[model samples]
Target: MTNRTRTPRTRYAQSLICLLFVWAVMGSNSALAELTIRITEGADAAIPVAVVPFSESEGIPSSDKISSIVQDDLAMSGEFRTLAPEKMLSLPSKRSEVYFRDWRLLGQRYVLVGALNRNGDRVEARYELFDVNREERIMGATAGASANNMRTLAHHISDKVYEAITGVPGAFSTKLAYVTRDSANGEPRYRLQVSDVDGKRAGIRLESKEPILSPAWSPDGRKLAYVSFETGRPVVFIHELASGNRTRIAEYRGLNSAPAWSDDGRSLLLTLSKDGNAEIYRIDIQSKNLKRLTNHWSIDTEAVWDHTGNGFFFTSDRSGGPQIYHKSSEDAEPRRITFGSRYNARARPDNDGKFVYYVHQRDRAFHIAKTDLESGEETVLTRSESDESPSVSPNGRMLIYATKQSGNSVLTVVSADGGDAYSLPASQGDVRDPAWSPILR
Candidate 1:
C-alpha cells in the first residue's frame, strides 16, 4: 500500500522538476514579437479555392487586404488550398466581373470575390462566394465594422465562406488564450495573452514577474480563468477581458490550479490540494460555494465537462500512472478511459461527444491523442515529442496545442482528423497553455 501511494507522488515530483527546468532555461532578453504563422503541413486533398484581391476605395487606409486575410484563414485550415492572387488571370471584385471559364481553367473549385469601401469612420465589405464547377453564386453578404477593425471583418467573411463550403462552421474568428514567458533585466516575466485563432492581433491580459499556467476560457468568451504565482504561491483568478478586472477565485492553503469552467459558466472545476492531497473540486463562481468532486489519495486534476454537461472527464493517477477518466456525475465512480499509454492527461471532449483528446506519452515523447468514446479506438494526433495543452476549437473541426519548434515552445493548429498543421511561433521566448474560446454571440 505504501509503495502504491509513493508511485504517483514520485511521478508528480518528477513532472514538477521537469517544469522547473523548462522555466529556468526559458529566460530570454528579447521583447515579445507579433506571432507569425507558417503552414507546416497541408492536406493532400485540400479543396482548391481562389480569393480575388478585393478592390479598396481610394479613401480606405492601406492595410492587410480583407480577401487576402480570408485566403490565409482558409489555407491555414488545411481543408482549402487557396490560389495566389499573383497567379490569377484576372482580379474581379464583383460577380458580374467573374468569368467562370477563367477560374475553371485555373483548376479552382470555388472562388471568393470581395470589395472594400470606406464609409465615415467605418469600413464596409461586400463579398460573394461562387461554386466554380456549377458557375453559381452560393453565398453573399455585406458586413461593416469600425475602420480599425478590418481584421475582424475579414475573419467574419472567412467564417461565412467556410461554412458555406463545408457543413461545419469556421473557427477563424475565435480567440486563443495563452501564456508567454520571457526574461527582462535578468528577471523572468510571464504574460497571459489573448489573440485571434490565427495568432494575430494579440493583446496581453495580464503580466507578472512570476509564472502563469493553465488558462481556460469561459463558455461565453468574455472572461478567462487561470492560475498565477504572483503571490509566491499558485492562485486562481478570473479575468474579465473588457473591463480588465481580475477577481481572486481560489487561494487555498496548497496547490490551486487547472481551472475548467462548467458548461453554463456558473462554476469552475479546480484542482486544489488544501484538503491534504491534490483533488478535483467544483466551485460556484458567484457564491463561492465549493464541492469536492473526487475523493482519492492519488492526484486528481485537469477536469473538463463532457458534451452532455451531465458528466466530466479528468486525469487521475489512481491506476499507478496518470490516465484519463470519466465520471457521469459528481458522486459517480470514474471509469478509466486511456490504457494505450502509461501517461495521459488533460481530456478535452468535442461538442459532438464523439471523441476526447488528451496528452499521451509514448516511450519518452508526449503527443496529443484522442479516444473515440464509442469505439474505444485511440489515435495519436501529433508527431511532436514535447506536445501538451490540447485545446479543441469550438466547432471541433480544428485543434490547437503547445509544442516545441526549434527548441522554443510554440502553438500548432491541425485539423481535427490530424491532417495538415500550421504553427504560431513567437520570435523570442516561449509560449504555452493555449485555450481555444467558444464562438462568440
Candidate 2:
C-alpha cells in the first residue's frame, strides 16, 4: 500500500498523455441575452439600503438602466433589501446632495447615488456610496466602458459598492456557464452558453443536437472543459472563451467524462473508462501527462481539487450506493466523508476550503447540501427537489445548481448558508450544467 500510493503506475497513462497531440491536430447579452433573475425567497432579515436612480447627463446611452441594474444585482444577492427608486426622498447624484437624515428616517443604512456621462462611444459612471448613519461618503469611484457595455459597467459599480459595504468582494462581475436544452422542434438541441451573474448578455458557446454535460471553468476564467456527444460518443473538450476554439482533450472506448480543473489551471481531474470500469485520472493540460489518482474497481468520478493541492473529494459506489470520499494524497487511503446518506457526489469546495457542497439525497428527494469540513456538520441549502450540478460563486457566498420545477429543468441559486434563494428558468428551454467562473481581476 505504501509503495502503490507513493508511485502511481503509468499504466497506459503515458500513451494516453502522448495522445495530447493526437487530438490537438483537430481543435452578451444584448450587446447578450441576459438571464432574468428573480428572488423567489429572501432572508428573514436583510440589510436595508437605497440605490437612487442616476441623473442622466443628457448624452448617456439609451440602454438598460444603470442604477436599476446595480440595485437589482444587489437585491438578487439575497443579502440586501434595496429601497425602490419611487421611495427615495431625494434623487441625489453626488455626495453633497445626499441628505443622511432623510435616509435614516427611511430606515436605510446605505445610499448609492451616481451619474452617467457619454464620451464618444463610451460612458463614464461616477458613483458614490454614502453611510446614512455617519452622514459621510464611504466609497466613490468612476468606471468607463463603451456605451454599448453598460451592463459590464453597471456590474463593476455593483461590485465596488458591495465590497465597500460588506467588506467581501462581490461576484457581480464574474461569468456563468450553463447548458440549455431546447426540444422545441422535436429532437433535443443543447447549447452551452456563457452569461452574466444575473443571466444577462448570454452568448452561446457550443450548440449540438446531442447532449453536453459538466461544463467546468478554468481557474483563470478563460476556458471551459465539458463533455460533448457530438462525435457520436462522449469526448472531453477544452474550449477557449475568447476565440471559441476547442481541442478534443479525451476520447476513449467507454467513458471520457467529468472534467475538473486543478488550482494551477495546468491540469484536469477526469474519469475515464478506457481500462474497463470508471476511475479517476489527472491530466496535464499542456504536456498531456496523465497520472492515475484512483485505482479502485468501483465507479469513481466527479473529483474536485481542495485548493490546498493536498487531495480531492470524489464519489464512489465502492461502499454500495454512491458516497463521497476524500483522499489525502494521490495514493493515500480513501476515507468516506458522507455518512448521512447513501448517495452524495459532485463535491465543490469553497475557495476558503471551509465547506464542500454536493448533490445529496435525503429521504427520497435530491437537494444541494454542504458539509462543514472542520465540524463534520451537513446543511441542506436548497428546497428544490430535483437538484444537481452545484457550482459555487467566487466568494463562496452563494451557489447555483440545476433543478426541475413543474417538469422543466431550471437553475436555482441559494446562499451558502441556505438563507435566501433565486431561480433562473430559461425562457424557452431547460438549463443545466451550471459552472461559476472564478473571480477575474
Candidate 3:
C-alpha cells in the first residue's frame, strides 16, 4: 500500500483494529465521572448581558442560584458577556425595579431579573428580560418545576431568555452523550454518560472494561445507540434512557460499529464488516431487517445522516486517503465532498444544511474544519492539533468536538462560525466520542 493509503488506515482504521484485538483478549466494570467546563476563549463581538440574582422568598431552602446557571450557560456559548452580580449597581427582581439608565451606564445592552417563590412541593420563578437601550420589557414568563429540579427550572429559564434575545432557540436544556475512560486500580474502566449541556447532572448509563465507542442519540432524545465490546466483540445496542433498558441491535460476527440514528428514529445507518469489508448498511430498528448501502473494497465507516434523512455522509478511503462522501439516497451513487485534506473523516453537518464539519489534517496536526456546502470553501474551525468527533448543536450555532488538552482528551465547544471557545475536561482520565442530543420536544 502507498503511504497515503497507509496513513488513513493508521489514523482511523488501525484504532478500530487494535480495539477489536484488545477486546477479544480482555474485559471489567466501570463508573461515572463528571465534566467541568472552563471558558478558554471569548468572541470579540460578544453581546453584553446582565443576569441579576433572583430573590428567594422567606423559608425557601438554599440551593444553586438560578442566575448563576444562566450566566454560565450564556457565557459558555461565547456569544454573550455576562456582567457579574458584584458589579451591578442595583439588583432588580422585577421590571419596575430595573433602571435602564444604570444598566446603560454599566455598558450592558440587556438585563434579566427574576424572583423565586415556594409553592407547595414546587418552586416557581417569575422572570423578565429588559432592553437597556429601549427601556422596555422584551420578555417575561413564570416557570416552575419540582423543588428538587431547580437545575431544570434554571435551564428552562435560560432557554427562554436566550431565545428572546438571540432570535435562536437556546440549547441549555439539551443533553450530551459521551464516553469516558479512566483506570481504576490499574484496570481500565469505560463508561457511557449523559449530562446537561453545561456538563452538570451527569449520570452513568452503561459501564464496561471493554472500550465503548460511537454514542448516537435518537431523534426524540429518549434513547442512545452505541457500540460496545463487553461481549468480547463489538456490538451495537440501543439504550433506553428512562428505564435503563438496552436492546442489542447489531451483533454481526466480523465488525459492528459506528451506529447513527435516522432523522425519524425508526432505523439506523451502521458500518459492518460481516460481508468481509467494512461498508455502510441501513437497518430497520423494529424489523431487524438489514440493507447494505455501499459495495466497496476500501473501508467505509463513520456514517451520519444529513439535515435531510434522504441522504447520508460517511468516511471512505476509496480514492486513496480517507475522504468524506455523500449519497443522495441509499441506492444513489456516492459523490465525494472533501478534497482539501488527505485525512478528513467523521462528517457532521449542521441542521440548516449550510455547512458540513469534520476532522481535517493539515501538515502533522489534526483540526476540526467545515466546508461550505454551496461554495465548497473550507475553513478550519479549531487550532488544536488533535481534534476529532465534531458534533453540531441543534440550532447549528455551536459545534462541539473532542481534542487533546495537556496530553489528555477533553471536549471543546466553538461557535459554528469558529468564534469563542470553551473546554469541558473530565475530572479524571479522558473524555471522547461527544454526541450532542437533539432539542427536547
Scored by lDDT, the top model is 1
Q: Write the per-residue lDDT of candidate 3 for residues 1-441, one digit (tens) a residue.
A: 577755754455556667544532232223345699889877999999999999999745587678899998899989999999999999989978888999999999999999999999899999999999999999999999888888899999989989999999999899999988877877788889999999988988998878898899999999999989899878999999999999999998678988999988999999988866688999999999999999876889989998888899999989998999999888899999999979999899988788999999999899999999899999998988988889999988998998878876788999998985688988776788899999998
Number of the top TM-score candidate: 1
Computed on alpha carbons, the lDDT of every model, listed in order, comes to: 0.88, 0.83, 0.88
Better of 2 and 3 by lDDT: 3
Q: State the lDDT of candidate 1 residue by residue for 1-441, as single tens digits.
A: 597766767567446434633543464566774577998878899999999989888777687678878999999999999999889999999999999999999999999998888889999999999999999999999999988888999999999999999988889999999888888887888889999988988999999888888889999999999988889877899999999999999998877888999889999999887776778899999999999999887888889999988789998988988999999888898899999989998899999999999999998999999999999999999998999889999999889998887787789998889985699998778888899999988
Sorted by lDDT (best first), the order is 1, 3, 2
Error of 1 at 438 (Å): 0.9
Model 1 alpha-carbon drift over 4 Å, by segment: 1-29
> Which residue runs of candidate 3 sit more than 4 Å off their true CA positions?
1-16, 19-32
lDDT for 261 in candidate 1 is: 91
- Best-to-worst order by TM-score is 1, 3, 2
Residue 252, model 1: lDDT of 89
Collision count for each candidate, in order: 0, 13, 0
